[model samples]
Target chain A: TQTVSQSDAHVTVFEGDSVELRCNYSYGGSIYLSWYIQHHGRGLQFLLKYYSGNPVVQGVNGFEAEFSKSDSSFHLRKASVHWSDSAVYFCAVRRNNYAQGLTFGLGTRVSVFP
Target chain B: GGIITQTPKFLIGQEGQKLTLKCQQNFNHDTMYWYRQDSGKGLRLIYYSITENDLQKGDLSEGYDASREKKSSFSLTVTSAQKNEMAVFLCASSTGLGVYEQYFGPGTRLTVL
Candidate 1:
């Protein structure tokens, strides 16, 4: 079985400040990692994904995440955040083999203040 | 690009009532999934289908039933609504099951009175 963990339940940051949300996963074999953002009551929108390649993957709105194999982690980062970035972010993982659904973390709620 | 649509943005049901939520995808994807999202928690998969008439149970499939009558449509039913039960049901699809990004619908907010 696979599991995802987002340690931070809620994070508050000032506008224009850099932010990082931590994500950790445990899987036996090859896996895929992805991030999604949900604003208020809306559905989640895909941000970026990491399978294999450069450890650093860029996503929408100046957001990027780094995959660390040794750490078993994929942490999302942004050089500068805006007020619109306030939302709940989710980290998900899936195995590469079959048609199984993704296992998601509890999620990290980001609140950007002006 | 294609889109996923879920009907009845909000659902209100009584205790012991059976409610159904519908989803349709124009992406023509081969796989579809239903997930339940509680307040302040991540999504839990309820059921999934790889093709028409094929159903697979997920981690949270005990109190729910699912149907995939056609390729483009998938529906989920809550067996018996519990009092004061409130959660969001999300529907999503992918081009294929493995290693593909999922496209999510707006979701259906279910409230039991």
Candidate 2:
């Protein structure tokens, strides 16, 4: 089984400030890594995913993530955060196979202030 | 872009009551999933169906039942409601054809009294 870990439970930042959310996983075989955002009372919105090739993947709203094989990490980053970016971000992992649902982390709650 | 709709935005049930939640998707995806979310936590998969009448249990499938009546509709039933249980149920769908990305519904909030 695959497991995901989002070390930070909450992160607070000001508008225009940079923010980074840490994510790590433990799996022996190939896997798919992705990020999702959920606003208050809303469903999860897909951000981006990484399967192979380039280590850096860009997502919606100026958000991006870097995958590190040596570190077993897929950390999300944003150059400048907006107040609207304040939400719960989740890191998920899925095995590279069929008929499998994703295993999610505990989630990191980002709070951006003006 | 297609959308996923879940019926009854909010559900309140008595302890031990049998409650059902319904979901529909216009994406015509071949796979559907049901997940539960608790406060301050991430989602846990309850069940999934790759096709009509096909059910697969996930890590947290106990006390829940699921059905896929057609290509676009999937439903979940709470066999027995637990008192003070409050969580959100989310529905999602995917192509089931090698693409792993999924689309989600707004979700149904459930509260057991």
Most accurate candidate by DockQ? 1
lDDT of 1 at A66: 97
Model 1 ranges with Cα > 4 A deviation: A95-97
DockQ of each: 0.75, 0.65
Residue B80 displacement in candidate 1 (angstroms):
1.1
Clashing pairs in 2: none
* Candidate 2 local lDDT, A1-105, one digit each (tens): 688999999999999999999999987667688999999998899999998999999999999999998999999999999999999999988854457657889
Deviation of model 2 at B11, angstroms: 0.3
Worst 10 residues of 2 chain A by lDDT: A94-103
Superposed Cα deviation of residue A26, candidate 2 (Å): 0.9
Tens-place lDDT per residue, model 1, B1-113, is 99999989999999999999999999999999999999867899899999999999988899899999999999999999999999999999998866789989999999999
Off by over 4 Å in 2: B97-99
